[model samples]
Target: MRAGVRNLLNIRTRRVSLAPPGLPRAFDGFSILLLSDMHLGSIPELGPAVVRVIEGLRADVCVFAGDFRLYAHQSGPTFETDLRRIVDAVRAPAGLYGVLGNHDTIDDARLADCLGIRMLVNEAVSIRRDGATIRLAGVDDPHTYRLDDLDRALAGAPKGAFTVLAAHTSEIAADAAHKGVGLYLCGHTHGGQICLPGGVPLLVSTRSPRAYACGEWDLRGMKGYTSAGVGASIVPARFNCPGEVVTIEMRAKSSRTRPARTSCP
Candidate 1:
């Protein structure tokens, strides 16, 4: 199949719901749309398709896991145009937030501002609803940039508040669990982008456990999802692994059924 046809045919949405321990009542049923590894400049034609998919989804908050642009030093005119189109099309009541990926440049912050999306670089922000709050923390790229700092990201979070972290790669899973992070959202491996039959990844480009190559998993004590992502990289084609946009519904764990705390690696 043609690259565009393959991408169009494979782009799909994955919905997941979780009720992790200690979730606040206010955040119960909170829904989030997770988008990652856009790699916009790589395949410019896919931009509108991605925007269309996002526009059709409904969620309280939208989180972009990263790779807004393809090359580290590519010109911004095209990237800015395509990114603005995609960002403008999204609607989220809670807000739109994102972090940078290895292929993105520092100047992409200006693009983020243009799109009205908050770019978090090793920082945390609190979103309130009905007088209750949840903390959203984000770190820099952990792959090519190697600039992630989990401590710095979670330093400003309120004590005992439910915290969700966004990073470019699942490599931070262990560290995030150690810090008591409740949910971790990331995408970089693309589930190998192109995989063998039965969805066996021929290669997963991260230090995270093999199981975390894609989909949801319990990393130590933290709940996490590594998205297959919406765009391709290295090559603009995907085989068995389709591109994805993830929807995560967060429900509060039942108080009576809360499990005892266990040590995390």
Candidate 2:
């Protein structure tokens, strides 16, 4: 257990691809930095480690999957200070987007807004590049709060424009797929937080399928990737599942594809 606690700083950068069919040519090579479940105050020192990794990386867009603070309804100077530090270190030219997790509150959303993270609570935003636009829709925390409205979040998306839904948990995956979503990005289980060998998880907290609880998964052709996350929850420790900062490259492909591959650095 002590070793697992010390492994909290072993934050690896996992690289994968998101090549959902019908992706616009403009976004063929778009890169996204996915950060999630950063229960910040759980381990104070984890902040600088994350910042260091962010400083050395760049992405077209950065998405925070939520759980900014360690506990729900708990915020203080330390949490705010650490949150600001981590957000300020991001290097996404397109923008920083986020959704709230079970551990976050409305005030936490407001705090993220103050830090320039566009919190998409039951809303959507469009990202344009070279005359092509892709929609990013995010919902509220669906694990504990269950306040997400998929229709409201995806209301204005055009007929066939590729849409990516960012929820804190993958519980809404089936609904999103039914609604024509092309890609889904989320992180809530922390990859079990304490896994056995080969990174096999002992428990994935969400009620979603165990398949969608960790890495890349396909639900009826819609692609999704659940981050292992950058910080711990429940306790500041990790086992075989080292926390991760995921970088995903979006490609234009058909044929019900899987990610191009995963590389570690």
Candidate 3:
């Protein structure tokens, strides 16, 4: 790890938050905590820290967006213990949902099942509350080997349900938008793992444009957030773009009024 980056991790993960806009009325007061790109294999403080953050956030639903592990090679052992410990912290009003990132391995299946985490690897599930239904689908990270078929990921979803898709890369937002998805959540860029002045990511993964590097994005009618993530890679430290715990409250957008706060265009 870079000496400077190590020092930042010692300061604790940073909290970057925003409310998801364009939501329909069903989730008016719901809160969903998003954890993505958690490169737990490299960062030591992250696992324990994720545990602490989840307990504190107390969100109604916690979504482990992707990248629970960083190295496919060591994932069998390190993630066997550490990653599960980190992900186990997540809690939702009903249950936690997860997807696999490029770095994740087959071993993640054990942990995902052990923790009762809903594994969304090319699958869809329905969540219901207040006599309303929300359809959520999770797709494996496409950057590694699998071909990303948006149509396949959403094959069985019902129409007019609050459809949310979780993939590892923010680029999937476009596909979600095209498919009329109400919400999309993902994180694979690590928010560039480094930030320049004015919160600009100096570097980013291949999944998206730099503008959508670390926060909320408005894509036509689709709305979502890409967390800066709670872990690291290449180096085990974050500079200006510190680790993140993002709190997302799902509000039902009203036709009568514009959202109280819209994301930066």
The global C-alpha lDDT for each of the candidates, from Candidate 1 onward, is 0.81, 0.88, 0.69
Q: How displaced is residue 52 in candidate 2, in Å?
A: 0.9
Candidate 1, residue 201: Cα displacement in angstroms equals 1.0
Q: List the residue pairs that clash in candidate 3.
A: 23-253, 24-252, 60-93
Between prediction 1 and prediction 2, the one with superior lDDT is 2
Q: By TM-score, highest first, what's the ranking?
A: 2, 1, 3
Q: Which stretches of candidate 3 lie over 4 Å from their true place?
A: 1-24, 75-78, 255-265
TM-score of each: 0.91, 0.95, 0.86
Model 2: pairs clashing at backbone N, Cα or C within 3 Å: none
Residue pairs clashing in model 1 are: none
Residues 25-142 of candidate 1: C-alpha lDDT, one tens digit per residue: 9888888899998878665567877877787888899999998887777633466777888778877888999999888888886679667889989998999888899899999999
lDDT per residue as tens, model 3, 24-99: 5666767677788777757555566667766665677777877787777664345556666755566666778888
Off by over 4 Å in 2: 75-77, 254-265
- Overall local distance difference test of candidate 2: 0.88
Q: How many backbone clashes does candidate 1 have?
A: 0
